[model samples]
Target: MNIEHLNVNGMELAVVSSDEIVIIDTQSALDLAMTVKYETNVANIVIDKNIICEDFFILSTGIAGEILQKFINYHVKVAVYGDYSHYTSKPLKDFIYEANHGKDFFFVATRDEAIQKLTETQ
Candidate 1:
């Protein structure tokens, strides 16, 4: 796993890439928030999609909502970067599209895009 801290848009963001699934549940989301805060003192993060559980992409499980809520409650703005074309659900696609338009959460296709989206508050 590699974690890097970046300064962008007047905020610091922790970018993490792990071979294993790092965020699988709400608890994992808390854990990651703590880790990133401790390491970089940043509430913003960009994580590789491969490090997140597949369940997060399945809206039926409600995993994504809960996990994202935890991030929000903890003041952690997150951007998940990867290929989202595999998900065929319209709701999920709409969710991602809307998230990308929001300030706190984003789903993007690349690390650079993740950084850009995560940092752009306006």
Candidate 2:
């Protein structure tokens, strides 16, 4: 994985890029947050949605909730950026909508937007 660090609005942020799925489960999510924080001293992160498991989009799988909870518990703010237009599940859509309105988690269409959202205070 490649981590690019940025300072926005006096906030430290890490943008991670990888070819494979980085977060397959809740443990992995916590590990990612800890690793990023330790390496970059950043509590905020921006990751591509493709690096996350596909099951995370399926609300019934419970992967999204579990992994996101880990981020919250660890005080890590995460922004996932990608093309989400293909997903048709209503529950997932609603989940995304709700998350977009919150401070901790964000779902955006582009990396620039993700960075902008992370920098803004709710």
Candidate 3:
């Protein structure tokens, strides 16, 4: 895993890039936020969607909201970047659509888009 601190539009963010899959449950989500806050001292972060656990996309488990709520609660902004076209669930699609439009969390297609959206989100 490669963690890099970047300044997008003058705002600092910790971006994590990895080829290895990372499972992010509610606890891990909090841990991630804490790591960014303590290690990088950045409130915003971008993660490659490919590293996220597959279970995260399953809305029925309530994992998505549980994890995302932690990010919001901690005031840690985040952007998930990758292709979401493979997911056909309407609820998931709707969730992504809603999140993309909102400010707290975003689902984007690439790191550049994620950085741009995160910048706009602030």
Q: Of the pair 1 and 2, which is ahead by lDDT?
A: 2
How far residue 51's Cα lies from its native spot in candidate 3, in Å, is 1.6
**Clash pairs for candidate 1:** none
> lDDT (0-100) at residue 27 of candidate 2?
87
RMSD of 2: 1.0
Which candidate wins on TM-score? Answer: 2
Model 2 per-residue lDDT at 75: 85
Per-candidate TM-score against the hidden true structure: 0.94, 0.96, 0.95
Tens digit of per-residue lDDT, candidate 1, span 15-112: 99998998888898789889889988988889999999999999999999998888888888998999998889999999998887778899999999
Ranking by lDDT: 2, 1, 3
Assess each prediction's global lDDT (C-alpha) against the native: 0.88, 0.91, 0.87
Ranked by TM-score, top first: 2, 3, 1
Better of 2 and 3 by lDDT: 2
Residue-level lDDT for 20 in candidate 1: 92
| TM-score, predicted candidate 3 vs. hidden true structure | 0.95
